[model samples]
Target: MRHLTLLGGLVLGLAVAGGAQPMTAAPATTPLSAIAALRDPAGQVIGTATFRQMGQGVQVSVEARGLPPGGHGMHVHEYGRCTPGVDPATNTVVPFGGAGGHFDPGMSRNHDDPQAPNKYGHGGDLPMLNVGADGVGRATFTSDKVSLTGMNGVLNRSLVIHANPDDYKSDPSGMSGARLRCGIISRNGLTTRDYPLPGAQDFPEGVAYDARKGVIYTGSAVNGTIYAVDAASGAVSKFQEGGALGRRAALGLKVDPQGRLWIAGGAQGTVSILSPDGVTLKVLQTPDSPNPYINDLTLAPDGNVYVTDSTRPVIFRVDPDLTLTRWLDLGDTPVKYGPGINLNGIAATPDGRYLLAIQLNTGELWRIDLRSKAVQRVMGGLERGDGLLLDGRTLYVSRNAMQVVSKVSLSADYGSGQVVAEEPLRGLRFPATLAAVGGDLVVTQSQLDKLQGGTPETPFRLTRFRKF
Candidate 1:
């Protein structure tokens, strides 16, 4: 990953070179001493941040009193909970680890280079907070893209301190370690912001549903346990567990028309087929010829399964005999490496005539005619296109970079495309998969590995959207 200095001088140069108006740095108004104190669950004033309105942005100076001596990743997460005390059994902190991912206003892209020309991370990642041997560290930075006033006007979110530094572009969540400390970010003399969803709902991370049976199947990427959820009541039941699959990290779930549930085991690079009753489990390994970082899978109308490999940039077609064949190799696409193309999600049209795949590294969505094996660009200029689903005449695509979902209409020529809908997802973070259940759109937020730092409240979210 490339690291560009986000300094005031660079901001001016880029603005001028790009023929844009230069941004003026706003003067600090609120006194640093006037800022109110923020405390953790133990009632300790861990840090204090002074907020000032800037030119179309906000500058926040943060100072911590008793932080560990070193540099730490800091961010204003979406939620405000600061539950303390680690769990003795698991050595994990409680609700503190459950503060869902960053605050993604657009719901399109992932947490990467926010300065990228095309797609970037949201306005949550702040400058690295450093602590000295005296256990106090102070840093001042400006967010020209976002402000505390726009953060729901509450300015009462939590400032999460990560165990490790952030690489920034690691999707789902930054590779940063656990949440060491959390403090509620509040305005001077203002009350704390009220977070609507306190503790997250512990639903399945990646789920695929059977619209007919109203049954939802989910799997853990860490434990590899398959769970069955009653779609109507949201009751969870463990269907399958440890056998020969090692630690089953179920990435994608789909049910064939014949009532077979297909599970994409990401860790093992294999597919597990379960009977309609969710009793029997069958495993199929990837052929030796291809890279097997199985990310997403979908069943074609012909009863064969199409799976995507994130690392190899190829789509594999699996037959009943467990024979794997190359369905499409997308290495030839013109994609920029940084914001260009890395295959992540795969979906096919209802008739199985067209197949769509999302490039994670870029916002490019490719449409492939299964019959001709010809690929065409459908949509571009997205933040990070992750999950894709086709419903009726509209195609629903999840942009992990922008933190929003966009809909594109298919043209008669099959090559041209038009935007139908693009709406900001109010409370979604790194949504990884999209599915259609009985004409309704269902989405899952993988939350990736963000749970390690925060608590395991409800990292996996299942949301239903009605098409207008």
Candidate 2:
């Protein structure tokens, strides 16, 4: 009687300290959620877990089979790998050995009970998973110690299920046996054809992605903030806030060969050089004489940077030593929207001989000779060109106000081209810019037109356009 009473008291105290209250029915969660397949050592998926943002907390909906119709110790593990291996130190073969201990980013190592949300244990602890008679368990659990946003978030972490059930009070995994299931979390949004940028209300006009690092980056013009997404983990964090960028709007953004970010300073008469972590390195300022309204930028094969000016008639060039020079002068070229202002988008040839630029007034594609400064109209009637992306011989032109993207094929020389296809994006509010991230076309819905017209609602986003 005395032992049972003491045990009951200990459980109650632990539960109270950890704030272990009954979990309520899950309400609708924010769009910050990820799905991962629970797999065995044989690479066979046995279940799935979807982690979602629930208010200030997080909730994971788990569903699977192959259990023994009893309680199992299911937890978030430390490592993301799920392959079976031998622990090198001991050379002991284990099930899902690649998935290390419980996921405790801070290395708390205090494997406390998941129900008791106290500071006594590792944040990865979870409640005992109850499997039914049919060997399938379906349940939802919530936690306040971890979330899906900002640094050190739970994305990219692994979920693991033990062969035995948890004893609840034991430290360091509750004597749970070998890991039977393991899987790494992935953003539900990125796995689909269209990736959603939730809560982006500013004019999102720039996008940059590193396929190797699985990082997705975009910037907001109004707020002047840069946002980054860990494509592997679905964790979203602000890479840079606009205040550090002064009043200049981030328009066209591109990653250079040196892994630095070259940003177009719209109407700021400058180009900003940013570190890979979104820190401002230097500003390539223009001469105040012609009033450069630098809008978009691209790197040529010669390692020089070329930027188009929306107001001025010339394109600015940045040399290796940060020397700013006049690259090409369009001299009031007739364009689709009329003369005076032209050359909104620019791209350089891979061989470093010619440069392709679009005239905003005439919708004509012009190829400019790099050495002679000679310009010729290659293709005409490409209206409202705002942003241009070149893939092989293909050119993608973004018509900001029109919400349309035109894809065309250019000939070998700086001469002619044909329209391959067009994608309408105006339905996305007001898409203003684009970037190619891996196999998809990343489009930013700037909503600049609405802001210009005194629209009450302002919502911004980076919409992924996948090529079928």
Candidate 3:
């Protein structure tokens, strides 16, 4: 079995042009500090705002980029939530409108100046953020209206950036045209929430989510035990027993458009497609190989599922009709399958024209034309890329060993891309693969290294990064 204990150093390319990389997370020892990662409606994190305790008030510092050049209103909202919802006032959908209104717990009811007395203005009101032509903005000031631990504290609330400038005297949000970006305030600064699994021997790898049922599914690497978790309630239950239906190891998983679960059997050279109720619909196998390691799988627009085999340098395609075939043999191409995990995560373009895959051993990204079976190296420097999720033109790669997720913005033609951001999955043991749910990213803490070095952590878990 190819144990996922491979830890290779990463070499990332320069960041995307004109984009502001997210700030490094603050030290956990920092006292009374909170951070909010402001993200746009597209769910891309554009900037961050940090708050620190200073005497009786809170010192606020905000930095953001990739925004329009103008004066934009910034403020703290009543709720910590940032999901889109219909505004009660307009009865129309608005981005970050779920955050409710300004932080006026004192019932000030007036949207006065930031310099105004606390009793005369909303506590959430902040000075207008002036963005430069380069699409960057920075502001720092102290606010006496909000504390970190007192009755008026804004912990777990939300910080929002508005589309237009604030007039400083208008009532109810100062005519801030629209909520462009918003982030939840948290003491540890990170928005990842942990969901505990059943036992310690799991060493889970692949992760998938059923949006219709709000349930998350992960498979055990130790013995192929499939576990299902309720996304809303964080409840854990067994979806499938280990070694069921001859599945020895579950490496990668995906919920197809039909809600069926497609699982990759590591070292077994098998792929299992199970119905929503855990019944085995079909089990497909690849050709006999000496060292076949079925690593990951992805669904395409054309109703076909493409999978990767890390050892044999080949890809497998499972057609919608349940037929399985060796789709593309990389041994015939320039992508030499050498030692280590060769191909790990796989993603396909929405148009189903190309398939993007990563080389774990060499840190190279390749694009394969579906029609011609031609392969081209699109980008490199993703050595430990484990799981991939493509949203629009953005490709997110989970660097398991690095404990970070690299955000890559692809070119219009999927021929080129650049790493725009790398966010650390704080407190995660070893993030393997990831799945997107709404605006959040649900990741598997594989902890494979621990399985190799020592005892795995008790009660394995999954992590959810809010609006990642």
Please, what are the lDDT tens digits per residue for candidate 1 over residues 131-168?
A: 78998878887665444332222144567776567777
Question: Which scores higher on TM-score, 1 or 2?
Answer: 1
lDDT of 2 by residue, 1-468 (tens): 000000000000000111223222222122456777988778899999998756556788898788788888988765556777665445797877766666653445577777544345666777777899999988797776555532224565688888788886676688777787888876543322334555545677777776766777777676567778775455678777776758447777878877788778777777888888778899877878645577788889988988888787778899988788987666644333334447777888888898888877677788888898777889886766677888778787776654456677799885898765544421333456677765557677675754644331223455555531
lDDT by residue (tens digit), candidate 3, 1-468: 001121222122221111234334443334456789989988899899998766556789999888789999998887768989777668998999888888764556788888665567888888889999999999999877775543356766789999899999887888888899899887653345678887768988999999998989999987998988988779898998888889989999999878999899999999998899998888898989798899999999888999999999789999889899988888788799888899899999998899999888898899999999999999987767889989999998887765667778899989898876655544345678989877678888787866644345456788776433
Off by over 4 Å in 2: 1-201, 232-234, 245-247, 332-341, 454-459
* Root-mean-square deviation per candidate: 12.4, 19.6, 17.9
TM-score of each: 0.60, 0.55, 0.62
| Model 2's TM-score against the true structure | 0.55
TM-score ranking, best first: 3, 1, 2
**Top candidate, metric lDDT:** 3
TM-score of 1: 0.60
Q: Is candidate 1 or 3 superior in TM-score?
A: 3
Q: After superposition, how far is residue 175 of candidate 2 from its true place, in Å?
A: 70
Q: What is the lDDT of residue 259 in candidate 2?
A: 78
